[model samples]
Target: MTSFEFPGQYYELMRRDFRNLAAETDFLASLLPDGGRALDLGCGTGTNLRELGARGYCGVGVDQSASFVEYARRMGGEGVEYVHERVEDFESEDRFDLVYCLFMTLNYLPRAELRRVLRKMRGLLLPGGHVVLEFGHLLNFVESYQPYTVAHHRGDGVLVTRLARQSLNPRAANWRNEETLLVREADGRVSMYDNFFDQAVLTGPEVRELLADAGLHVSAEYGGFRKEQVPPHGRGPVVIVATAEGAGAL
Candidate 1:
């Protein structure tokens, strides 16, 4: 089994995948409300920040990956700023109109750690500011057994990999999943990495309860930006839109 670590070196590669999967322009347009300031947790290579900037929002991206942070700085535009730091230890006196965690990054944290991170995000948002979380629908695992391969070419080099052996433990409530990544280079060099993730797979009702426990209100829960209800069989990812209670409401 391959050991997974925070801020992996392949983050930029993963970012490219996300940019393709997520309709960044539309997603940012839908989430940015009046657009004062925004914080992107687990910002990866800052692709989302760039998308938000294009939509006229000032964006700051935070990620644990130093390589990703540096790459983002070099690609900077539209008032985008990148910070290299872990979400748990990141400190800021400034608050944001919107705080977002996307791409199932929150699932990497343990339950206690996930709660701590949520509370930290809560503290960073202005009263009534929105927090949007996007994660894979856990129920999809029931049918997700097929292996898939993805490849990309950079200059003269090619990166090819196969992902296979998907498994999940739903009873744990943390949505633990396992898979393997096999990497091959044009130079004939090969490497393999095994990835294990513990995701908090809250059903719609469970998510509502968790948000309430965190002192936030569930403004919306969508299977996708398409705004469909979560299908019983989990056809798509889940997007959660929540708002911190205004000071008066608190």
Candidate 2:
């Protein structure tokens, strides 16, 4: 499986179309304790950490893209740090009250490597700490498997268009995702970027089993960040919250 290296200049613009950073940060913050320490795995551009930092939460964000890390550092605020490193190689001596891997980041890791990463995340947690994971919903994949396009026009005279396609590879037991981005700058210059990767197809039960194997207990499963319960054929992402085994009182 390969990983995506997003274009740093256009990432924030692309993300604004799908994610509400402020609302997502608020939801994540609600899970943390007072002045808690948090770690973000695959934290692209460090937007969430920047938001969390303003709430007095000390945050560390790790991503593989140097451009993203550099951009994040440039937009730095108090209590947040950005590291340029792959999730597999990132290590910290200090423990955190919350460790989160969002946007289906774990799906890119090989199964065995993913298990190891989960174990590592478990080790990095303080007692009573929580680990939040987000994965694309299996039902959505199987039910609505089709190519899609996203287009954004900014007031700054930049137009962005993304063509995305994903298909199941039955033999590989995974899905191959391909995306092409076309960006037109205000100066009439156009650039194209392409990204392709294979991701594991994960369901709630599989996520539960995996977390249990890593010594984490599932405490809640939501269809979205708003704590919505998942229906049999819901179209939202699968968000799971798990706590470390034998956790102390928070």
Candidate 3:
């Protein structure tokens, strides 16, 4: 499986402190009634899982990184159950009211693997249930794809600067993202860490076809946070809300 085990707690620290995706969780909560069960695919740090639990939903989180899973379990307690396994290998007898594949996690899988995971997710959902997907779109690459990205985030008396360099492979529909992080402590101490990972790049038609082939269909497609309709060639992540097969016929 893909491993991000390098740099120890740096990756966990960088992500565990981030809570911006709480808005996505809020949006999802608005769609479900009480007693909802949620499965978070690629649920890094279990932030969304904790948020869903706080909102009165039963939550399960899965991530391929063992460190991430342990951190999630430590933070979420009994409210959220975190599994240290790939989404493709994770299974359960319980069906969910909502399934989440967010933050471009599906992009990490190759095309055929993406289809298989989607099919597995479909089987884990109840009738009328929905799966929410957010990932880079074709336009995202054309309009916003940058070879390099740098950012600094503030924390308790420490400043963390992240540098990302990416190389795209149009033929294989994939890309390699290399990340280096520099952590500057208040006491004049500094440490640098790095890691690299590959992601599958996909177009709208490709994603739509995969969903349909997996017995799922897109119900809503948004380009932004406020439910903006995805344009022909728009920027920002593509947020697609899909439903299990025969959901409307029920």
lDDT of 1: 0.68
Q: On lDDT, who's better, 1 or 3?
A: 3
Q: lDDT (CA) for every model shown?
A: 0.68, 0.82, 0.77
lDDT of 3 by residue, 6-61 (tens): 43345555664543565677778866668688899998777777777887888888
Q: Could you give candidate 1's per-residue lDDT for residues 1-250 as a string of tens digits?
A: 1124423335555556544535655754665676668999988778778877877889789887676688778778797898888777787898988898887776655556666677788888876688888775556554553444344424236463535444446566645446455655568787776666556655556556667778777777777665667666666778888887643221
Q: What's the CA RMSD for each of the models?
A: 4.4, 2.2, 2.7
lDDT by residue for model 2 over 1-250, one digit each (tens)? 5545656668888777777777678778988999999999989888889889989999999988777888899999779998888898898898999999998788776666777898899999988889999887567568757766465646367877878887778776688878887889999999988877778877677778878899998888887777778766667788888888765322
TM-score of each: 0.76, 0.91, 0.88
lDDT of 2: 0.82
Per-candidate clashes come to: 0, 0, 0
Worst 10 residues of 3 by lDDT: 1-10
Quality of model 3 by C-alpha lDDT? 0.77
